[model samples]
Target: MAFSLFILFLIIGVIEIYAFQAVKTFTKVKWVRLCYVIISLMSIVFIVYQFTRFDRSVGQTPMFMITVGLMLLVLIPKLLITSVLILEDGLRLIVGSRNYFNNYDKEASFLPERRRFISKVALGIAAVPFLSLIYGMTVGKYNYKVLRHTLFFDDLPDAFDGFKITQISDIHSGSFDNPEKISYAVDLINEQESDLLLFTGDIVNTNATEMHPWIDTFKKIKNHEFGKYSILGNHDYGEYVEWKSEELKNKNFEDIKDLHRQIDFKLLLNENTKLKKGNDEIALVGVENWGVKFKKVGDLNKASENLKKEDFKILMSHDPSHWDAEINTHEKDFHLTLSGHTHGFQFGIEIPGVIKWSPVEYVYKQWAGLYVNMERYLYVNRGFGFHAYPGRVGIMPEITVLELKKRKKVV
Candidate 1:
């Protein structure tokens, strides 16, 4: 799907460039004529399909986004030219113009005064969201502080009570070439009064060795009973990277497993543990990363092999997709699931009830914030470390302090 969109953009960009060149060169016939003729037709089809699923051929690729810019470029001139015609025609009907617009002239009446006004307003509506996106990128920072007061389950066992769980996911540790930036993130996490820290996958981008240099600083962070726990993300299994030998790749994964143990983070590896809180106990289950068409390290079968279904399980699964596919399907078995690979696309909004945003929402339904499926809930963190880009534009780095609150039973 991505490649298709890229190629489609490449084609549209070529036509846009050619059209611009033709205008600059003052060609007798605009090169945009033929290309736009096609787009004008496609737009009619696309807009219609958006309203109904009655009939269709698969779906259109979003490369049409690139086409929107091209269309506006051509539409603007047509808009202005036709707008003058409508005004002159109105005057002809009102007073009279020497070169009056006649009902007989089709081109002059192409856009009547009232319809032209409405079309211009429609164009502005289409452009508002794109402009707001730019504004959000500049003014908004993925500020995590707003999350300090969100509702949490308070009756969670003291073994994990006031247990601030600082989570960071999709670290893609190998992508960071800067050590100072990494140190800053480490310092921030360490600064929080977190009882236990959880890293729910994608710890290393392509190799287990990626998290090596930062290990020293990471060890400095406080973790104890509420120590630290981790699970594999889709990228952790080295599936996307090409290796000289499969054995070498497997060995590297093992090394990553041991490394987490060295840092005091027990890699859940499809297993559950009981954290004692006074007279009560809460279960923490960590599964290997598994999600749609990605790595399948999640061993729900193995993870729950020896555990009781009634146990209050807090699962650490990398992808939220896992919750949809496995956890949610297990009835209301697990109380809560913690996941973070989404990074909220490192962009988008999480405002509740006002206006919600995030492209990742179209991918994973529970891409950010909290979600309740039946009784099992999932919290998708926006991650601590940045991937791909070192700077965050909208989505800020996060250190979530989730206080699991429990309500008294209603008889």
Candidate 2:
């Protein structure tokens, strides 16, 4: 990890240096050139200092945000400028080589127009991402969207025919800096007034203490008629942080579980509960944090211990990979599964049916939204809060409203 970080900084330093030279070339004024160089170097130094000294406990603090904002402001533009420069240099190399080979006696002068044009173009192109990232950190992160979908199922119990389930996942409470914003989000969730409110985990980033501040804020979200149910996500395990002892880690885990109880959430860990209306019933199974790469403590068989094969089941597993790995192939078909570990990488473009792309797609096959195969289904929520990146881009915080309806058979 140390070596990898060193290499990353080294590469970044090189890029900053090249970008600084470009600034000098572009700015004809002596004072402006000197000031630009000083600012660039100072930014680099600040980046290194803040990044190395960054404490996750104070992640959402004002100072940390300022540090992150400054880092992105300087680094993203330079990286963009470097990318543009590389492309232009490649084109120049190819053209220059061809000319040199064709004319042995003729003298060739470097294109001053081309150099200046590339520099100007690079700067202009660099500004686009820089501005986009600024927007992402500001308005884009907290921009909440309610995605409503009605799913039809042949085997859905008549009791749940028109049942509504509100799903929110990946609420990394440690990263939430604003209480009013969260309170507003809670109100939004309550506005749906769904029968079942399901939270697919990641309540805290690392330690259970992170949830202490927001407990009162989150308690405002009504549990609805059927009550709120939640399953643990990978981050809820308290494995990412450095603990003084195993006992302390265990305590943190227990505290997090108790936190759920305080918020009126029925925390299910490899368990099944029957949701019934009159004589009709459906099974809601929730498993512990299960991921392909992370912990795989979720025992489907244990969760479905008393469940019958023909029972209409809705499984809640944090990682979407669990659906494809175990739930899909299980003898008893899981009618619907809810997950939200990927958080769509907290970055992606989703235009409904048009284009949905994120770097996380390569890692997790079932990253976000609804995915169906045969009779089984999975709905991956985009997440309720931000994590590592501190902010979201195109993929904003989500509040998913799923209205369940039974499919009518043809005569």
Candidate 3:
């Protein structure tokens, strides 16, 4: 992952250098152009190295060091060009009012044209952030395409009766690093009046330590009479980082598990529980991260142990891939399962009827919203918190309220 990211950034740097040279057509000077390219590339590399902690992730020895060096090489040049253009814009803007066309210098030379040129450059620069804000607020918040659906279930139990479960996935508490926004999400979830609440994995980004500060905020979540339950996401397992030892890693995992106890969420580690509504008893089984690449070791049989042959069932496996890859073809299928690992690639178009595309769709058929396969149903929440990028760019944070309607008699 580190190598891939570094290469991608380096490619970005090279493009920046090429772009600046193209700008040389507008502002010509061999000495100035060379200096700009060199400085800009260097600055970009430096910023990226500092940003990604290339020093700390020194695993592949010299390979890691080389990638970091290359990333810095690529990062600095672009950074420099961007900074210089900003300063040039300020210089042009401070000069008394004049139309940009009138200000254009046709023959004085590249240096003389700097003012109008940089002003245009500045306007372009300013447009990016403003446009980013507009996109993040509007299209980003409302966009998603229902990938594949398991909504047409024939065996959905009336025990849930008319339950609409609003599921959220991968809140990634570590990423929430910010407190205010998390509280706002909690308020929204509570206001939704969802009949049952489900958290389909990744409640925290990683570790019990990350979850400590926001315990009170998460406690505010409201659930329907049927109750709220959760499984674990890949991040929740604390598997990526190195611990003092396996024992220490195991201890850290257990501590985070206990944190779930504090939040009143039942951690379904290949385990089942009865969700009793009146006389109706349906088994809600959840397993710890039963994913393909991650870990598929959890024991579904153990979770299903107490389940009677006649009880209706639902599984909360974090990855939807688990459903099609294994659970869908399993001898016994749960009436419904809930999952949320794909945040719809944090980009897509979801409008009323004509929705389409999220890169996450490539990996997950049930990427967002609902899907129905024969009698089985799975709903993958598009997540409630942002990850990788701190802000959600093209994807809105979701509070999925699922309405679990009962199927009428087959006879």
Highest lDDT: which candidate? 2
Q: What do the candidate models score in CA lDDT, each in turn?
A: 0.64, 0.85, 0.66
Report per-prediction Cα RMSD to one decimal: 10.2, 2.5, 9.6
Q: What's the C-alpha lDDT at position 176 in model 2?
A: 83
Candidate 2: C-alpha RMSD after superposition:
2.5
- Candidate order, TM-score descending: 2, 3, 1
Give the lDDT of residue 2 in candidate 1.
91
Off by over 4 Å in 2: 1-6, 54-72, 98-114
Model 2 TM-score, 2 decimals = 0.92
Tell how far residue 346 is off in model 2, in angstroms: 1.3
Q: Candidate 1: lDDT over CA atoms?
A: 0.64
Give every collision pair in model 2.
none
Residue runs of model 3 more than 4 Å from their true location after superposition: 1-13, 25-43, 51-130, 133-153, 308-310, 408-411
Please give the distance, in angstroms, between residue 209's alpha carbon in candidate 1 and its true position after superposition: 3.2
